[model samples]
Target: MTAPRATKTRTPKIRENLPAPQTAEGLFFHYTPEEAAQWTPFSARTLRDRIAAREIEYVFNGRDNYLTGAQILSLNERYTVKPFSKTHTRVAA
Candidate 1:
């Protein structure tokens, strides 16, 4: 009897919307879910969940939702932990 061949499973490619080149200085661009995922460790679905739960702020440009770089940075900052300082000594009661 012939051995059955194993089929290869492929992951679907995520389509991302690239931001346009800045026409003026100091102007920022918005990112799609896929693009935002590239900047953060969370997946696109997580981002969407965050948006739905109002955990993160987002902008709706008439038809589509977008996130700004500042917003992503703010989200990251919210989860960042500050290191504990070990300079002070405990006082005896």
Candidate 2:
């Protein structure tokens, strides 16, 4: 007798639009790359690239990846550069 082969299967999910989860600050939800592109200057492709590169934190919900608002804000802060003061000048020895 031959052994049975294993296979993978996918199930469909159906649900109505729901609001984001509530927190001490306010409502918060994980955004897909497509949605994240709307609030960010980067495109969905760029965000996905970042996700693949592990440049930013993300949640892998079984099938898809998601980013929280906090993660986006953290990424912004991480890459932000401080401007040099005009009063500062280089001294020549």
Candidate 3:
């Protein structure tokens, strides 16, 4: 008589509810407005304004818009710049 075969059970190791990065660059996640507000120094409204102004880059699916982590880095590059005041003006050579 042949021995009975054993059945195997598999279980997923990670939770499906956890957020995952969308891009291989690891710079983007799908975040709701509230989540973005807490993570970003800029308020949701201000972020929206910047988006409208094209000072920053973002992606929008039909339902929601998100700024990639790369976008955040880009913002840090240019957003902190202060305008040149008269006191700091350079004289023509």
lDDT at residue 1 of model 2 (Cα atoms): 94
lDDT tens string, model 3, 1-93?
A: 998887877532332342433345537655543445544668877887876787777888876667766666566566677778666677999
Model 1 C-alpha lDDT per residue in residues 1-93, reported as the tens digit of each score: 998887887554555455432323202567776677776768888998888788888888898777877776776678788899889888999
Q: For model 3, where is the 10-residue window of minimal lDDT?
A: 11-20
The candidate maximizing lDDT is 1
Better of 2 and 3 by TM-score: 2
Candidates sorted by TM-score, descending order?
1, 2, 3
The CA lDDT at 57 in model 3 is: 77
Candidate 2 residue-wise lDDT, 1-93, digit = tens = 998876866433323353333342313577777766655667888998989999878889999988776676666677678798789788999
Model 3 alpha-carbon miss at residue 60, Å: 1.1
Ranking by lDDT: 1, 2, 3
Q: Which stretches of candidate 1 lie over 4 Å from their true place?
A: 1-27, 90-93
- For each candidate in turn, the TM-score is 0.62, 0.59, 0.47
